[model samples]
Every structure is written in C-alpha cells, then in structure tokens.
Target chain A: MADAALRRTPLHDLHAGLGARMGGFAGYDLPLSYPAGVMAEHLHTRAAAGLFDVSHMGQVILRGERAAEALEALVPVDVLGLAEGRQRYALFTNEAGGIEDDLMVANRGDHLLLVVNAARKEADLELLRAGLPESVTVEPLDRALLALQGPGSEAALAALAPGVAGMRFMDVATVTLEGTEAWVSRSGYTGEDGFEISISEKAAVRVAEALLAQEGVAPAGLGARDSLRLEAGLCLHGHDIDAATTPAEAGLGWAIQKVRRTGGDRAGGFPGANRILRELAEGSERRRVGIRPEGRAPMREGVELYDSADALAPVGRITSGGFGPSVGAPVAMGLVPAALSEPGTRLHAELRGRRLPVTVAALPFIPSNFKR
Target chain B: MKYTEEHEWLRPEGDLVVVGITSHASTQLGDVVYVELPEVGTVVTQGDEIVVIESVKAASDITAPLDGEIVEINEAIADEPGKVNEDPTGDGWFFKIRPTDMSQLDAFMDEDAYEAMTG
Candidate 1:
C-alpha cells in the first residue's frame, strides 16, 4: 500500500522535506531513511547522534491509589517498589507463562507511565482495563515521542533543557523544551546514551528542528533503529519475544526483580509467576543465543540451524538475522537447546543446499553504551 | 544495453553480456551487505534467479536476462557488498554470461523505455 494511505506522524512533513525514503511500520507511514542511507545512519548514531520519531509507540498513564500494587498483579517486576521518577523494563505475560508484550513502565510522582509496543497497543489497553480494579484509571496519552540517541545526545539535549543532564539513565523529568513543556526520559532502545522526549504534536517539529540544528544530530528511520536494537541484544516485540515465548525462554529473567522472586516478601503474585519462577531456578530447555556468521554469507530469518557442517537434522530456526554495520559482521539470533547456547560453540546454518558455519556468540554482538 | 522487467541491466561486452541491478533497485534495497554471485560454468535458463543480494532490510534475487553459461563472477562483492550501493552499474557488476542465443537481448527494454518504466 502507498505511504499516503497509511497513518502519518506529526513529523511527516519534516521527514519528507529532508528527502527521506518512506515505508510502512505498524500502522504509521514512517521514514525508512533520509538521504544519508541506513549504513551511514547506523554508524552516525553510534558515533554521534540520530533523531528518531517513535510517536507511534503507545504511552499510557495509570493513576489512582495503589496503582503500582494493582500493576504488580499482571507483571512479575517489582512495580510496587519502583522509585518515583524512575523507569523499569517489564513484560505482560499470559497465564500460560508466555509473554504477551514487552514494555517500559516508569513511576511518575502522581501516576505510573507505561510505554507499550505499537502493534500491541489496543490489546494491551484492553488487558489493563479488564484486569485492573475500578479505583485505577488507565489513560492513553496522545503525546509524540522523539528519541535523540548516541554519545553526543546528552549534550545536544541539555542545551534545550538544562535539567535533563542532571537525571541519570532511566530517570524522567518534565521540563521546558523550546519554551514548551515536554516530558523527557533518559532512556532509549538503541542501547546508547540518549533521551526519549514526549511532547505535544504541535511542538514536535519545532523541538526536532531545534535539536537537528545542533552538531551531529541527523534524523534516522525505523530501519536503522531495528539494526541498532538487534546489535544491542534487545528483543523486538513480535520477532524475538511473542505470545508463545516466555521471558525465561527469551533470556529476560533479569527484568524480574529480586523482590518479586520466590524468596521475596511478595513472591509469585504476577500471572505465570509459578512457571517463570520454576524456569528461573532450573532454566528453560531452549535458549536464545547470538549467531556470528563465519563467512560473508548473511543467513536470514527462517533458515534452519544444524548441529554440524553438512548435517541434515534441523536443530533451530533464526528469529532475527541481518548485517550489523556497527559490528562490521553478519549477526543473527535463534533458539537452540540449552547445551548449544554456550559462547564460541560451533554450529551450522543451512542455506540453499549446504550447511554454512555459524558460531554461538554471546548476546549483544556489540557492546551497549548506555550512560551509567 | 538493455533492462529486464525485473530491473536487471545487461550490457553486451563482445560475445559476453555483463549483468547488474539497476541503480533504482539498489537504492530501494537500502544498504547492500552480502551478495551470492552465480558460480562460473553454471548453466542457467532465461529469467531464472541466479544471484542473491541481501540488504540490511531485505533480500532480493537478480534474475538472468537470457539463457546463458556463467563465465566470470565478481568476487569483490563478497568481501564488500557496499559496492552494489556505491556503484550499482560499474564496479558492482554481478557476473558475465556467454549467451546461448543472442536474440534474447531483443526482449529487454532500451534505455529510454526502462527509464520511463522506473520513473
């Protein structure tokens, strides 16, 4: 379908004016890249900074007394203990111990802020409404989210809102940006030191233009964002973690805080907690591990993985695969048996009619540069 | 010189025909990272997929313009596939084929017709 027939963000005009090649993501018509192209945009975000329009992602406010306590019933994370003005990674799990969706929840002073994936917004909204008590209110915010990411991002953002620099990673603050009120969070998906600014649609272009005027802040697209997150070992919602894969299977047990574990005071209250706790203690049978291609051949998703070179018995399948520009190598991720997930273990990815050499490398083929 | 409907470009070089993806196709694929070049001495039929080009976003197939025997393959693309994006028509040529029937070239579009089709 044409980009025009799809939903567009407030920054569409700016992206079009910058000569970006457009594509469909979720239900929005987003920029795939500007004139700089994907490789340059990826490298640029790693070295400098890249501006991304992530407004399509869902943002909601959970208000009322006992908001955190109400939320803890649906997720395994220690939501009740989350400090004000701080963020935490969470997943909405099903009763069967599978992940419904992965999301970010922040403890605002008066209310809790939740950022869920774009594709699961409607379902997640209904899930929350169906589960939460009458005292709790779920309010979806119509705010535009813009992410300025890289080593140079803080400096560029601090120029507009000086107090933002004072907040550490996962910190949130509502401050004035270009004479307009905007909520700023010191977090991003790229694993880089960056900030996600939530502002009104009317002020999105103005704030983006002001940030772009700074040195080395190029506008990026969803293509670069996907490659960036993959290199960082972060899971994409439907691709890496789905309704069929549990947090333990996806290697996301760390998101379950210690206070919410078996021995803690409030243990095993969230949905699928019993199974998740069991898996946490014993480990899941299948594990998600990184695959480093030995050759230049880029083995893509759905390719069957084999135990040995020239072997026919299929062992696993690739979930996400591509050339990681920052790593300067082809990187992929797939589920394999527990015994085959160790780093440096040799494996094979069947392509065409032959089995190509692949090694089980550690997750995050590239190191994360999040500001500590 | 001619262009196939699938955007494969062919240029007659003496008795051999050199093939590459059109500049339009390369730009659409974004950054080309890996390419599977056709093996030399392989016999391919007209319009068969013989080469695989992978970009960061997707993978695309480059089909043969005519029935031919692959003579020479470009090994440079294996080490650095960005050449496909840097120069789609020049250094990024996929392979050279010795055509089994020269009349197959007449089925492709000329420069003007291909330009109109792409635009």
Candidate 2:
C-alpha cells in the first residue's frame, strides 16, 4: 500500500472533519464514505443530489496549430467537427482495436480540454506525446474537478452560474464561480442531469463548500460513485473495457460518428480503423452484456459465465459487478459470446463451487435521467 | 468466555464453543455488507481461515479460534450481515464448534487480558 501522506486532494481536511473513512485511490487520500455510510450516500445520489470530488482525474490541454488533427489520429471520435464550447466522449485505442482509455474531449476556445481516468492518466499522456504532431502542445492541468449530480444538480449549478440551466448536455462554458473563473460542463458519469466543474486546486475547497451548503447536496465518495456509474450503465476503465476489448464489443458503437464508417469520407484514417470498421460491419465474437443474477448474491468481477448445458461450457467472464442502488438488485456486465449477448438470454455465473442462474438484461438497469 | 488476539471471541456452550467477532473488530470494520460462513460439517484447525466477511470498503478473513469441527452456523448473518456490527460478541455469534482438542483453549486470552491487549 502507498503511504497515506503521498497525495492529498483539496477536500482532505474537510472530508476528515466530516468523519469520512479515508482510503487510497488514484494516488490521493480520498474519502471512501462519510459518517452517513456507502448505502446512504449511494441512495442519496440517486434520490436528490450528491457532491463528488473527482480531482484525481487528469485534465490536459492540447493547443497549437495541429492539435485537432493530431488528436484525430489517436481516437475515432470526430474532433474536427466539435464546435467550441462543446464536449464529446472519445476513446484512446491501440493499433489492435483495444481501448487504452476513455476520455471527455471539450473544445475550449483556445485549446482542446481532455479529461481522462486517473489511473490511466500517465500512460495516456505518454501516448499523446509520442503520437501527437510536433506542432501541437500538450499541457497537464493538475487541479481539482468536482461533479454535482442528480435531479437537483441543475438548480444547484444555476445558483452559481446564472443561465447555466439553459445549457444542454455536453455543453461547456467558462463561468465565474464565487469570483473565480472555472470551467463548467453539463456532463457527468452518473446517468443523471449534472455538471462537472473544473477549478484551480486552491479554489476547489471553496467551490465544494459552497455547493455542499445548498439544500439536498451531500458529500459522496468513490464507493457511491462506482455504484452510481454502474447503475448508469457507464463502462469503467480497467474493469468494463481494457486493452483486450474494442469499442464495438463494449456496446459503445454510438460514440463512433457515422462519417467515420466504411464508405464515409474519413474511412481508414484512425488507428485500429481496419479492425474497428470490421467489427462495426460484422459484430464482434464477444460482447459486453448486462447480467441480472436470480438471487441477491452479487456476482463479482472475474466470475466465469457458463452455458446451462450439462457440460457447463464456459462462454464469458464478468467485467464489472455490484449492487445497483437504483434497481435495488445485484447487476453486472460481462464479456459473453456474441450469440448469448441478447437481452433475456439465460446464463449461469460460477460463484464459489456453485453455478448461479443469470439472465441478460438491458443496461442502465435504471433508466438514465440525462437531459436529452 | 475468552477472545483470541485475532479478535474472535469463543464462549463455552456445553461441550461446544460458540464463536463470533469482537465488538472492537466490528467497529473497526465499519458496516458489514456480506458474510460467508463455513458449512456445518466442515473441519477447521486452529488459526485456519474459516469465514469471509466483507464491508463495502474491503473484504477480510475471520479465522477459527481453535481446532474444531463446525457443528452449526448462524445462517442469519448471511441475510443480515449488519447483525455482526450490531452485536459482534453476543447475538452475532457466527458458529458453534466441537473442539478437536480441549488444550487449544489455553492459547486464548481471557476477557480482562483481551481488553488490556486491545487497549
């Protein structure tokens, strides 16, 4: 285990004062939960509003002449079409159609803003530096990012940035928050209407405190964050999609633009375009499927999925599994044979020495509340 | 009743010993979300890992206090693991055991000694 003193977020003191159970995550000593506990925090986020300090996520700026062109070579997303003050989800892919990481690319007026997973930040930076054209510049914004999510998030953010409620999903704007200039986005990992505020390390404490002071907003930790994202049907890096998986297989085909398809203008341009295009045309051999366990026993990650036949042939392996707070049941996503990926397809998950019955289900077990 | 340094408490119940977690251990572990107990007929040696307990934060192993055969397990903990957090040393008793050797009890610490060690 890394030493607890190694890294600290801006909310460290505030979380400690609130009696939070501290844990090491993404190189920061962050709260695992407050005194209200994980279940309460999870339910709180689903019901009203919850504040999360995701400052550990890597924020970067790609600027200069070839920034957009250079970034286009790395991911399949159409970055050139993204208007200023708009954000889109993109994936970092290897030459073998494997996902390096998933990120949010925001078109800041002067530079392209990229927000990536905390654990994969260092490697992602290295990949960008090596592949990005020399004319483009990459700079890391080592600061605090806070996510205010749930139904009441719109009103909470509107209180700080007037007219922010008019911004649609995936829209970014630079707004003055508590007299400090910060970037706010109508986007979040939780399948709820929310905003992600990017503030300076020094200003994060004030912003978080100001938000938490509002009605129906409480501090949530990584534990609740995971459950919320899972219930939202979002794929977590390293768990749901890794180097071994492709975007198509992970059910993220919607993210790939129609212009990048086989007969389109930008055909065969991005890395892994050949394999990715093939998978886009002809489905992958294995695909990620949501599994609903028959009983309350949670089928965890790495558990094998077996066919119900007498031989009990192994067909897939679970990637992410946990209790879905909104659904009030145990749900999981697994990489199963493409034939068995259809919803309602019955399968079994091997737990301990017994095989538990499971059925494939539509993801986001609870319907997403995104502001369409 | 006596407790082990591992924080398991064992109480004499006729020829059997009823074992459970200590209050100190429960409080340290936070909310108990799940519990996996050994089968009734499973044979366990002293210091053997006999149960798996999980909180939302992490999972931990609960060891057997002495060499014994599990005679009965508290199935209630399977459904409501929080019972362990509510009364770890009393109503949260995990299982009863038929000791393989009565001399194993000598290795355990008494209530006063256990309390002093914890302090």
Candidate 3:
C-alpha cells in the first residue's frame, strides 16, 4: 500500500518528528527505522531500553456475563477459568485446524480484553462478532499502545508509576501514569523485561513523551522490534502462523492450556478441537522450527530447505528470516518435516541455487529475559 | 562517470571501472552486516545483479552498472561489511569490472544529475 493509503496511528507525528524511516506494513505507514538505525536500536533495547509505538495493534473488549464462555467457543484456549489481572496467549482456529489469528487474551476484571494483530483486526472482529452469542457485546478501544522494553524498563517505568514494579510477568494492571489512567501489562513481545502500556488516544502523546524523556529509553521502529522478536523465538502472525497452519504444527501447542484439551473440564468445544487434539496426541507432520544458517550470507524468507546438496530431498520453506543483530548471525524460522526438526540436525537451505548448510537449533536464538 | 536509478555508481578507474552503491543508497539501507560478492572472472551484463547486501533489516541486490567481466571484488567489505556504509564510493566499492563497451557509461546520470533526480 502507498503511504497515503495507509492509516496513521496517534503517535505518527511524534515518529515523524524523530525522523523515522517509514515503510508500509500491516496497512500502516509505520517506522521501519530511526536515525540511530535498526542495529543500534536493537542492541540498545536489549542492553538498556527501547520504547516502541505499537498503537496500530488492535485493542478490543468482549463484554457480558457469558464473555469468557462465549470466547472459548471461538478460540482453543481456556478463557472461562482465567483469573482476573492475568493474561494468556491464545489463538483463534478455523474448522479445518488452520489459525485465523494468534492473540493475547487478558481477564481485565470487568471484561475479557483481546489484543489481536493489527493487519487482521477487522477479520478477527468479524469472526468474534459472528461466532459469539447474542449476550456478548464487542467493543473496540480507540487506544494507543506503547511498549517499554529492555532490562532497564522496570526502573524507568517505576520512576513514573511505582505500582508497575509489583506486577509479575504476564500481569495486567490498570495503573495511573501521573494521574492518567492506563492499562499497563507486565509483558512484551521482545522477550525482554518490559511493559505494554495501553492508554487512550487522547493521553497517548503525554505518556509517550514521558517515557521517551526518561533515561535508558530510545524509540525503536518495526525493524528492531522484528529482529528482537525473531531472536526471542516469537512468531509473527501472518508469516509464521496463518490460515494454512494449525497451532500444533506451528509449535504453538503450548498456547492451548490443558483445561481445553482432552480430559479437562471444558474439553473439545472449540473449532478444530478434534484435529488439534489429535495432533497434540500424535504430532503434526511438519513442525515450525528454528533455522541457523552457518555463514555470512543470510538465508531469506521463501528459501527452500533441502536434505541434501543435490536438491533432491526437499524438506520445507522459510517463513521469516533475518540477521539477528544480538545473536551476531543469521537466524530464521520455518516449517520443516518433523523428522528433521530436532536440534543439531544438519540441513541444507537452498540459497541462490546453492545448498547452504543450516543447523536445526532450538527456537529463540537468544535466551528470553522476561521478568518471571 | 554516472549513477544508475538503482543507486549504484560507476566510475572509470584506468582500464577497469569501479562499481558500488552510492552513499545515499547506503544511508537508506542502514547498518550493512553482510555482503555477497560474485567470484572474480565472472561475466555479467549491465542491469544484472552482481552483489547482495544484507542489513539488519532486509537484503538488497546491487546491479551491474555496465556490461562487463568481473575483475575484482572488495574482499575487505566481505570481512567488514560496515565499510559499504562508511565510504560507499571509495573503499566500499563492490567490484572492479572491465566493461565490454565503454560507451554504456554515457547512459547513466552524472553526479549533479543524479543528486537532483534523487533529491
């Protein structure tokens, strides 16, 4: 999409002021880099702190008495038993075992809050609207989301909102920032200790400015955010898990809690539960695994993976691949045959017609530093 | 002598002309971490991709400026890819190509023309 056609977030002007290298992504003309660039931004985030404007992400509220039970009918997770102020990673599956979208469901006391992918917001909402019962009311929050991610994040946030320090990883609290009400979650996608602050569009600029003015906080664009997540072994929705991929095959079987799986209290009520449960018992044929190419030439997405140098034995394809700055090498994740998905298994990723040696390593090229 | 729309620069250096991405191109690319150069003695035509540069974000191809046979590639860049961003037109030059037809250099835009076009 052209820049003019793309939607602008509340903090678009702030990014423009900071001279962000904007690109068209997820139907938005968001920043791809800053003046400091991606490498510096990525390293800074891991070492110190990085604040990202994730306002383009969708914030939704599922209301009513049957909210949790109604949500369970659409997703494969056990939302019905979710404790207040806690969040769980969940996915909405189709009837054929493919994922519509992977999301974050938080039981925010009064309502079940969902954070869906920015690109798939409308479709996800449509599914939620059409799939749920009449008692449930779907509300879209016009909010700006900012992520304060890194080792120094807690300190920076504590300086402003002291209550944020007490929250554990995956904990959600509606805290006040200088008296401005905001929903602060002790969670982030960067695999670092940080918080995702959800504030109204009216208060977005104030909160962002405050965070940026703090020490050890630099503005990171989507480029650094991507490399951070990739190194953390986190999957980008459309690229890694999509309508063609099931949670079991995508290595996201963990997202489905035991309460919704076989032999649990609320078992087998959601879409594709049969196929997913069966895959959970008997593993899927193709598994999403991490790929580590052993050279300077970074293997990119759509690169074919072969078992031999002769290109005879085809295994899989790269979904997302990039140079992991922190890891100091190229790291990629792709869907490959379950037989060859074991760690330390030597595989060949066909790059430029040459079979480049790639090793099947564990997901997350770097260890996650989340505040558990 | 001239620049391509793809942001590659071509300048005659004795019998062999040097080819590299322009400084503007490097700035836009940001923090080049790796470079893939073709082997010496390879034959390439103008507009044919000759080098691949991977940054922290994405990979981009550097096209040949003129129909030429590859004489040399910058080995220093292969070891220290950041040189491409530091001195794009000098030490960061991607390759030295012996152009088959010297007249092709006239087709590209000169420095003043290229700057105005990009600006």
Candidate 4:
C-alpha cells in the first residue's frame, strides 16, 4: 500500500525520530526495522527487551449479562470458564470449520477485552455485532497497544508499573503505567516474558519513551516481530492460518478446552462444531508442520512441497518461511499430508525449479520462555 | 569502474572484470543470509539471471551484465553472505568474468552518472 493512503500509528513520529525504516503493513505505515536492522533487532529481542508499536491491531470490549456464554457461541473455546484477570487465545470460526481470525480474549472482571489482527478488525467487529445479542455492547476502543518483550522485559516494565512484575503468563490487569492507567497483559506473540499495554493514544508516546529509556529495552519493528513469532511457532493470521484452515489442521486444538469438546457440558454449539469436533476426534487430512531446509538457501512462502524429488505434483506448500535470527538458520511452516507430518519425515521443496531437501521438524525452532 | 542499472559495480582487473553490487544495493538488501553464485567457467549472456541473493527480508537476483565466461567465483561470499553487507564493493565481490566483447563495458554508467542516477 502507498504511504499516503496507509494509516499511521500513534508512534509514527517516535519511530521516525528513532530512524526506523518505514513500510506499509495492514493498511498502516509502520516501522519495518530500525537502524539496528532486522537481524540485529531480532537478536536484541531474544537477548534483551524490545518494545513494539502494535497500535494497528484492533481492540474491542464486550459487556453484558452472560457475555462469556454469548462469545462461546462464536468460538470453540470455553469462554464462560475463563477466570477474571486471565487471558485465553481464541479463534473465530466460519460455518465451514475454517478460521475467520485468531484473537486474544481477556476477562477483565466486568467486561471482556479482545485484541484482533489489524486486517481482520473490521470484519471481526461486524461478526461480533451481528452474532451477538442487542443487549451485549461491542465497543471498539481507539487505543494504542505497545508490546514490551524479551528476558529483560519484566525488569523494564516493573520499573514503570510496580505490580506488573508479579503478573504471571497470560495474566491481565488494569495498572498505572508511567502514571497512565492502562490495561496490561503479561503476554506477547514472542515466546518471551513480556507485557502488552493498551493505553490512550495521547499517552502512547510517553509510555513508549519511558519503556525505551529503561535499560536493555530497545525499539523493534514489524520485521523483528515477525521473525520472533516465527521462531516461537506462533501462526500469523493471514499466512499460516486463514479462513480455509481449521483449528485442528493448524494444530490449535490445545486451545479448545475439554468443556467445549464432545461429551462435555457445552459441546458443539460454535460454528462448524461438527467438522471441527470430528477433525479433533479423528484427524485432518493436511497438517501444519515445522520445516527445516537442508542447505543455507532459504525456502520462502509459496514454495511448493513435493513428496519426492521427481514428483510431478506438489503435496503441500510453505505458508511462512524465513531466516530465524535466534535459531541462526532458516525455519519454515507448511501443510502436508497427515501421514507425512511426523518429525523427521523427508520432503522436497521446489526452489528455482530445483527440488531442495527439507525435513518436517517439530514446531518452535527454539524453546518457549513464557513465565508460565 | 562502471555501474549497471541493477546496482552492480564492474571493475576491470587485468583482462577480466570483477563484479559486485554497489553499497546502495547492499544497504537496500539488508543483511544478506545466502548467496548462490554461478559455476566458474560457465558461459553467460547479457541479462541472464546468474546470481541469487537471499536477505532476511526477501530474495533477489543479480543478472549478468554482459556476455562473458565466468573465470573465478568468490566462494567466501557463498559461505559467509554477511560480507556482502559489510563490504559490498570490496571483499564482497561476487565473481570475475572474462568478457567476450570488452566494448559492452562502455554501455554502463560511470561513477558520476551512476551517482546521479541513484541520487
């Protein structure tokens, strides 16, 4: 997208002042990298704290009687069982068992807060308004979300928000950050101990500046964010998991609680429950798996995967692929036949008309460091 | 020294030409991770895609600037691709080619012209 037509985050000036290289992503003219470059920024995040401007993501609040029960009707997760001050990863499913969008739902005692992908925010709002009862209020907040992630993230954030250091993984709370009341969640896309702080647009710059001023905290951009998430094996909404990908096929069945499964108290109520439950019980035809290319050449997305070097047709294709700065090598994720999804299974990815050897490895090239 | 529109810098060394991308190109590529160079002694034509460079952000190609035979290959860059980003015009040279027609070098831009075009 053109820069003039794209939306600017509240931290656009801050990023520009920090010498970040700007690019368009999800209708926003955001920072792709800083002067430190993507490789360095990624490594910095893995080693220390990296602050990110994720205001482009959508934030919404749902409030009403039986709000959790109403939300359970849209997603397969057991929302009603979610405890206050805790967060759960959820996905909106279509009638055909495909994922509409993956989101984070936090139970904030009286109301539930949702953080959805930027590109799907509008569609998700429409889904909420149409599927939800008139009594339930779906309020979209014009807020700025900043993510502070890495090993040093706790120390950095604790300096600003005193009680945040005590928060466990996936825990959410309304805290005063740098004297600004913000919703703070001890969770992030990177597999690191971090916090996602939702603050007003006016306070965004001040909070971001405060975090960056802390020791070991540096400014990161979308490029580093993508690399970090890929190493953590987290799926990008549009790339790894999309409308055609079911929760089972994407290996996200762990997010579905037993209460929402078959033979439970509230089972098969969400959209495409029949197909999703069946897939959960039996299995899906194609499964997403981690792939490691044999050589230095990186096999990127859209690369066709074949069962054999001489195969006339491809059995699967890579969805997300890149050079993992933390892993010090190239890592990828792709869909293949269920039978061939096991780790150590050999597959061939076509690159420049030549079939390159790749192995189906376990997900998350690096072990996760979540506080949990 | 001459430069191609594709950001490749050609420097005459003996009867052969040493080819590498300009600093501007390397800065744009941002942290190259892998480089696939052509085989030494392979005959190439002008505009033929010969070198494949993979950076952290994306993959790109360095096409042949003139009809020539690959005389020598820089194997160091193939092993350590980051050198291209460190010193794109010096130690990061991709290959040395013996041109069939030396007159083709005149078609490329000079230092001032290349700087103007890139500017």
Cα RMSD, model 1: 1.2
lDDT agreement of model 2 with the native: 0.87
TM-score of chain B of each: 0.97, 0.96, 0.97, 0.98
Q: Which residue pairs collide, candidate 3?
A: none
Using TM-score, rank the candidates from best to worst: 4, 1, 3, 2
Model 1 CAPRI quality: high
Q: Retained native contacts per candidate, as fractions?
A: 0.79, 0.21, 0.95, 0.95
Query: For residues A1-372, could you state the per-residue lDDT of candidate 3 as single tens digits?
Result: 236889998998899999998998888889899999999999999999999999899999999997999999989888987899999999999999999998899999989999999999999999999999889999998899999999999999999999989999999999889678989889998989999999988888889999999999999999999999999999898898899999888999898889888988888888898999999989999999999999977777899999878868678988998888999888999999999999988889888778889999998889899878
Single out the weakest 10-residue window by summed lDDT for candidate 1 chain A: A1-10
Q: What is the C-alpha local distance difference test score of candidate 4? A: 0.94
Estimated TM-score for each candidate: 0.98, 0.92, 0.97, 0.99
Off by over 4 Å in 4: none
Q: What DockQ results do all the predictions give, each relative to the true complex?
A: 0.81, 0.37, 0.84, 0.94
TM-score result, candidate 1 = 0.98
Candidate maximizing lDDT = 4
Model 2 Cα shift for residue A225 (angstroms): 1.3
* Model 2 clashes, total count: 0
lDDT (Cα, tens digit) per residue for candidate 4, span A312-339: 9999999999999888889999989999
- Arrange candidates by lDDT, descending: 4, 3, 1, 2
> What is the lDDT for B77 in model 3?
96
Worst 10 residues of 2 chain A by lDDT: A1-10
Question: Which structure is stronger by DockQ: 1 or 4?
Answer: 4
Q: What interface RMSD do all candidates show, one decimal each?
A: 1.0, 2.2, 1.0, 0.5
